[model samples]
Target chain A: MVIMRRVAAGLLVMLLSMMARAELVVEVTQGVEAPTAIAVVPFGNETGSALSEDVAAIVQQDLQRSGFFQPMARENMLGFPVQQSELYYRDWRIAKMDYVVIGRAVSVGANDISVRFELYDVLREQSLLSEQVTITRDNLRDGAHFIADRLFERLTGLQGAFSTRIVYVTAEQLAPGKQRFRLQLADWDGARARTILESSEPIMSPVWSMDGSKLAYVSFETGKPAIYVQYLATGRRERIQSFPGLNGAPAWSPDGSQLALVLSRDGNPEIYILDLQSRQLQRVTRHYGIDTEPSWAPDGQSLIFTSDRGGQPQIYRLELANRKLERLTFEGNYNSSGRLTQDGRFLAMVHRSGGGGNGFDVAVQDLKTGRLDVLTRSGMVESPSIAPNGSVVIYATQEGTRGVLAAVSLDGRVQFRMPAVSGDVREPAWSPYLR
Target chain B: MEIRSYIVPFVLALGVHAAVLALLSTHWMGHDEPQRKVPRHIEAQMIDLTALARREAEQAHIAEERAREAEQAQQAERKRQERVAAEQRRQELAKQQAEAETKRKARQEAEKKRQKEQAAQRAAEQKRQAELEAKRKAEAVERKRKAEEQARRQEAEVKRKAEAAAKAAKERERKQAQAEAELKQALAREQKAREAAARQASQAVIGDIQSYIQAMLQNGWRIPSTARNGMEAVVTIHLLPNGEVDQAYIHTSSGNAAFDNSAIQAVYRVQRFPRVADIDPILFERRLRKLSVKFRPEGLRW
Candidate 1:
């Protein structure tokens, strides 16, 4: 039969060459962003009379300062297994450990203790998070930052700004020419800081209050630069319409009934919005150029601030319902303190790139791919804030000549340094996720 | 010789009885003349005498005296001479019987002419032996009809040479089966062109180890900011012919467990892939064992 149709066409060309060589795939797209090693271990105290606070070194310094984790090194742990049947996952997968927390604390009631933790996944030997919490030995570092916010929201599906709170503005030269500005409020890992308003004069832009209880800064104590909203559990302070010449940049509004600030008293520094129940100030922007740093837009229908109109200090966007003034940064001519990302699709700021003597860093941009990404090469970074799980950004730089507070990670692959025991920390803000 | 053939026919029947008794008597002639003359004379005399006799009687007497003399004349002639000698003996018996019938007819005509020349010499020697036995029987029937026509031609020339050798052995066999089918179709077309050149050189070494495992998985991926541009995942891995990683997981789950553990920590951060350890173990067991990967972040900023 014609040799059976040439042996069935040579078996259909060997079954189409084995269906074109079955499975090899390969895609990937792009990555190398780094950091997620984790291991925390060491918690097991079982309260044998000494449990002051270690809760696994405060969840290994809050997942190592949230630059998205690389924790390990507790003398290089091979075995502090608090439970999961004494956990041996090959001793943290031979110590290359991708996540392993473990737990213990226990002393349940004379002053209430309980703690207990778990979080595993060491390369999927799988137990992702067990949990226990109790508290009160003076809130054991707030129950170890609520177990590092449930192991950073079960490994970064994002919502663990380590129990959030930051609010900077330090200054303190205290003697040479007498400078003592304060505004402080801490714990986003500058530990429990506290002094909310001390000022020898200049206190600058503080911000936070879409329900993290209130604190709107730029204080100059009353000689000038006004704007103070305070109320943090009643260390009370109000001062809003001090319109003489520049009641500095304030912000607030994602329905805390409006605040927005920056007002050159109708002369130059534009952007206004006040409303707090119709105390109505609303003059958005007449723009003669110096419209100061205002930042609202988590959909308060717009206002992104800091402008030089076109000549230099960039960052624009106004639309308070169609008043529409849009220039949103065109890359480096000193882009100013912008802010955005709570899904506003990224916009951090304070860049400087060559149009100035090259010093101010912190850039982010992407607002749907306008692609800027210069997340800090340090040089004197400034107020860049962010982190309500926009993964991180904390800014305020200058280390050797002292101004501290650093942070980074929105894919600039994690940087650290918060250094603030005494003075020079400048304008930081980051607060929003606090229930 | 049987008596000279009866003497010559008895000497010719004695000469014919001597001429008839020799003229029998010729004799009886000569003498008798004389006597008669005498008698006549006597008679003449007597006649006259008788007449005279009477007269004689008278004379008789005279005679009687003479008579007695005559008585003798009487016996006379004695019986006349006994009759003249019986007539010469019956003429010599008829001349001896006619010479014995002419000597038996000349010896029976010479025995019928010598038996008719012997019987014509025996019929001429039986007609020359019957013409030599009819020419020898016509030359033995003409040599048996030419020997039966030379044995029917030599059996028709051996029946034409055996049909021509059975038609030349059927034509060779059919050309030796067509040259053994054409040498088996040229050895099946040279074994199908050497198996298609060894399957195109192993498909070019499996496309260079699939681009060196896609640049070692994009330099060990890290993506997870809850990685969102249609977050994919997939992983798989399983290597070890020295390319290491012997097992990576997350076969498919972008339901985000931190984007599938950042794609199984980017295959354990590329634990090894030197260049797939310089390939070809049968092209790494046919195309680098198990790979998959995928992780779709699309250069993130999600």
Candidate 2:
């Protein structure tokens, strides 16, 4: 009996010891919001001559501008390994690179270059992506952006906005008083820009349709502010509305069936929804103050707009079904150009804080938590446009007394400036995710 | 007068004696003459005459009668003598009988005395034997009593000694038990104190390791922007004795591949925790061999 009890006690002790070493769990609730470091090795050129476009540079720039990655400089790389067989993971690992991109470009035809790229995790020594594309020399930059989009999506777990485009009005002072206001469309990185409309009158509030096939903006070419829908592929334009008073800030509904615009035909600047099919206008907000900048929610069930009915310009959500006007921003004196992200969980706006001397800056307010985060410190930032993936907000900010396009990550951690060559770029509009 | 009467009786007696003597003598002579005459009568057997013979016969008859009378007197005297002898014999016999009777009586008396003495001797012997037997029995009883008393005393002594020994042994045992109990208690207290100190030290080491690991992970983590506020990925990492990561995998996914992979990649980036290698091996095995990290991006804007 004594022996049995001793054995039992021994077993109990063993069991307790096992329980002690079951598992040690450590909780990590916070992490550095810094960009991931990646190595974009230069692509090997087998086209017999140097390609006009540097595909590696384009890919690197695209990833860097997304505010989620830090591409290693070419000079810092140990070797330019173009394929997995030649890739030495230890080199990148030593350089503290989390990921590596390697590729090679070969001429498939007289004008077509076939580019093959592969993305790898340096730490894991594993390949993440491998693809091949054939494109003309002119489209080589697009191919690089395409590769950047694929890598970005794989690395950040979000849709890459690199392949999308942005429309911003660039005012070039051709003369002392003559200003050429051009509604320009360009890549999201401000590359390959082209003017959709060039006029001496000012153009404002350029927004993309949901399908990314057309654009609707308030162009002043008709000698008054008129909303025009232009087919981007064909350069076809149509006047949607020409109100006697203010007709501006045209926003496309989520389904692209209607455009939500600001109109003062009712004796005050009010929010109106115009059905593109029926050409019928429906007033949604009847506020006495200037209610403008009507932006559709992703669900198209509601519109968040800037209204000054509360004695100060603030962001408000107007439910289209019930016309329920709920104030969305209370932390600022001037919050305008309220735009909801694709998920309708965050509202990015141009905010001027009530107490601080800081001028208009781009801010994002979490609609769920009602917490507002100022994403930019630029005193003159405006026209905040959220990326389709909600990872970044591109806005227009002044650089040395000239307006330039700049972007900030939603968490207010990463920022980059896109300075145009010869114009004051403003009212930047990020297009939805394009095909 | 007495003398004359005596003399007359003496004379009568002497005369009777003389007459008897004379008759006896005459009987003798008469008997001898008949013998001689019988021979002569035998010789003249045929010459008998009646008268002459009668006269002679008468004379002879007278002599015969005298002889006869003498013989009768002799016969009487013999008879008297015979009677006297018979009487004497009877007396003698009587005397002898009396003597024999006396002797018998005497013998009987002696025999009885002798028997009585023998009986007395036998009784004396019996008394002596009885006394000896009684003395021996008393001695035996005394001896038995002495033996019993001695045995009882010995038994009591033995019992007393045994009790003393038992009491001493019990006292010794009690003291030993008390000492053992106290020693055990002191040892228990010492062991408990040592254990508490060890536990505190182990806890401190564990805490240090936990913070070290947390910092390493945070610095290496590149939170994917797609990781929303509520999404969490749990990763388990196995480490070698040298604090190098042997294996790391997602224990629970956040449903987002990139987010989960980011957490895994963070562990891979750290690769090793040098602080862990410095800790005690036992502590490492118990608490740091396998670790679980929960990657929750609460710092993100969305």
Candidate 3:
């Protein structure tokens, strides 16, 4: 009986230790004080042949998705040497890159290849790891993600699950008045795309729940646009918001407790904070002009929202306390789609330029510098969602014939397009930093 | 008993982590100086080249004074040899010219003696013998001889004296030509040297200007070391186009007076950092005109 107790105690000890190690893994409740800086240069090709997956770019997307590594754009890369020996640390340091990654692929066979990669700590001036692996052509995308996962773990001290997916909406014109729409999800780097929903009506604003398991999006299936939360695993969906007038822009609150959206049942389109538990709605903003596109700040105290109350669709801030509303955007004649940084120090928004809509760009305003940086010179960008690290944002835009998801770094260095294989994909919302 | 056994390892890990965190956060006093290390510039450069960056961490740095001394010593050696060789060549040319002048004077005296012997035969007889009979012929011959002798003497004197005079003239001309060439060369060398020196000086000045900007930025950043975690503040900053701060407000308080002041001062201290002077003022105003800044002392996520 005494021996049995001892054995049981050892077993219990083993189990508890396992669980305790996972305690730090509990969704990283406390993020790093200073967000890491990562420089993701363009992936180099192997000497023998060309590769289908731009592995470097995919790796960049995977790292950027984690919201731990702030990816520096290839355009901003002063110098990118393929081999570790050729890497010039000064160039990266000048760009304030904390870590720099270089990679290349070698064709082992007609259908097989060995991809090689390394992550270097620019400040520490050391290669964090030399993780090299070989894979078939079918698994090249997985291989790129695997490298990203390893780097993410070493730097952010958290495991990265970006080898997963992205679900979004794509729209197209079928005829003069009729339009075709499709709901789609793809690999994190925009490969292996498949359609989830297809319709003639418009589908927009696809958002992922805290866990990447569920989605809440705006679908116009029932003759009018209504908000629906769908479970990806069981293909189960429940309409969360449906009203007579305008029912649009449904964004899930950070805690998954409530949703902040825009509705016209109150006569004008003002922001209404909906309680997910009680199904009770509280009006957050009351304005004459259009008040829409509400996004939650890191702390749930206040929400940064878009309103034209001061004239034009500009961003406005509403303090949940006393429900006081203040105009947040006054610099731009036309600014919309305001997304706050996780720290709430920076406001990333779309700035409209030129007379009568000739030019538009995505801009970032450092609240500290009072400095505005135009992140996207590209004309088409909508629904820009900043990553948890405030480094990059993914938004909806027209790419060729389809509406695809593209990302722009807040610092204006990196740009990427995620186009699905079937139908058009748009309105990409990056998930909060996943555990 | 079960809890007791679990407590040891748990406590040990926690203690080690806490100790390390404390050590890191405490700002250990003496470790601030990275001695026996490479220069900061070299350290900064090494990041680019993997091997070199690694090398920078390994090598012990030579003192600045010793390196400067070695460079100055090399320059001194080069100047010493060039000056000594120039002085030796000047002395050798002067000695050779003195020996040649002595030889030329002795040769001129011997030539005058040979001309005197040749003119002695016709000297006395031509005065009385041909007083009247050959007066015409004598006068003609005497005139022709005198003319020929005069021409010979003039030719000899002109050739030999011309050689001496021309040599003097050539020497003077050579000296004048050399002086002009030396003056031009000196001016050209000086001009080239001045330009090179100017280029170097300007480069240093540019570097100083950049360092001054860096100093201003570094001093301006001013994040207080004592800022505790869970620090939350809302700062609203207004901007002018061209990315300059027009005005800033501490819209939300972080609780700590010093921290809040530091945050406000950092923007002011920037003095014009994130300098986007080249961007269109209109675009800067439109996009980045007004913004809010928040800081969390404890990590932001929960």
- Give the root-mean-square deviation of each candidate in angstroms: 34.0, 27.1, 51.9
Candidate 3's DockQ is 0.01
Docking class of 3: incorrect
Alpha-carbon local distance difference test for all models: 0.74, 0.84, 0.65
Local lDDT at B124 for model 2? 54
Give me the displacement of residue A270 in model 2, in angstroms.
1.3
| Candidate achieving higher DockQ, 1 or 3 | 1
Best-matching candidate per lDDT: 2
- Quick one: ranking by TM-score, best first? 2, 3, 1
**Tens-digit lDDT track of model 3 for B172-204:** 999999997997678557755754674466445
lDDT of 3 by residue, A1-435 (tens): 558655765455445434533210001012223335678777677747667777788788677644444678888878767779889876776677667888777887778888778887664466877877788887878888778877766654444555656667767776889777877777665668667777887887777775666788888888888999888788898898577798888877777888888899989998888998999998877668888888887788888888777767778778887677777666657788888887788898888764775455787776654656677767777777766555567777766766667777555545776644545666766665444
The prediction achieving the highest TM-score against the true structure is 2
Candidate 2 accuracy as TM-score = 0.72
Candidate 1: tens digits of C-alpha lDDT, residues B54-132: 6524643654555466567755453554354334333433433343344344444544554554455445445544544
Question: Judged by lDDT relative to the true structure, which candidate is superior, 1 or 2?
Answer: 2
lDDT of 2 by residue, A176-263 (tens): 9999999988888888888889999989889999999999988888788998999999999999858889998999998999998888
The DockQ scores of all candidates, in the order shown, are 0.23, 0.39, 0.01
Question: How do the residues B198-281 of candidate 2 rate in per-residue lDDT, one tens digit apiece?
Answer: 568888888878888999999888887667789999999999889999999999999998789889989999999998889877
